[model samples]
Target: MNKIFLFISFALISITTQAQEIKWMSFNEAVKAQKKNKKPIFIDVYTAWCGPCKILDKKTFSNPETAKFINDNYNAVKFDAEGNEEIVFNKMTYKNPGYKPERKNSRNAMHEFTGFLKIQGYPSMVVINNKGQIQKTIVGFKTSEELKKEL
Candidate 1:
């Protein structure tokens, strides 16, 4: 009976932990959620070939604490800096049809958010208010605690 109770407890704990985290959103979905909820947008801009970007996704962003805070306070957006996803920003549609895939990155660029966000480094993040004003810009991989404070 004790073993059965412990097993049930562990299962419940796993489910509860998963429930605390938010599912990541695409850029457009994040933007729309911001409009509807009047919350800030937390955008994660990364390049597929950037090692630090992979670290951010695998280590930093995957933390349950970060996920919970981001879901609660902001609309989380994830974007690839060198992806072929066509996106419209600030009334202009940005594209980069000639961007070649670099190293082992999965695809090429078809967007100009790289320059628009002034991304000088990999694994950059930007926080924007509901009015489309930038609140903060963070570069590099950040721990869950650090990002939670920002949110």
Candidate 2:
């Protein structure tokens, strides 16, 4: 009976931990969701080859408290600055016209959306108000506590 109870406890703990995750959506989806729900959009502009960007994802975004806070306050988006996906924002279509598929994992052409945002570095956090205006742009890596405080 004690062993069964211990197993059940562990299972519940695992479920609780898994539930503390931020619901990340695309930029377009967040915009649409904003029209209905009116939540601020938090966009994580990162590149595949950026070391600090990877650390930001693993350390800051993976934290349970940070995830819960963001999930509650904002619509989160993970945007690849060097990716090939076409994004429509502010009534314009943005694309990485020179993107090379062969160099996807390495450095490639910067997406037009990234340029439109005027992002000069990796691991940039772009915060947009519920009314679709940019509130702030935070550059560089930030800890979970720092990110929470920023928001």
Top model by lDDT, which number? 2
lDDT of each: 0.76, 0.91
Q: Give me the candidate number with maximum TM-score.
A: 2
Cα lDDT tens digits, model 2, 7-126, are: 999999988987787789999999898888898999999998999999998999999999999998899999999999888877889899999999999999999999888898998999
**Which residue pairs come into collision in candidate 2?**
none
lDDT of 1 by residue, 1-92 (tens): 99999999999999988876666688777777777899888888887767878877777777877777778888888877877666676687
Provide the lowest-lDDT 10-residue window in model 1: 101-110
- Give the distance in Å from residue 20's predicted Cα in candidate 1 to where it truly belongs: 4.3
Q: After superposition, how far is residue 69 of candidate 1 from its true place, in Å?
A: 0.5
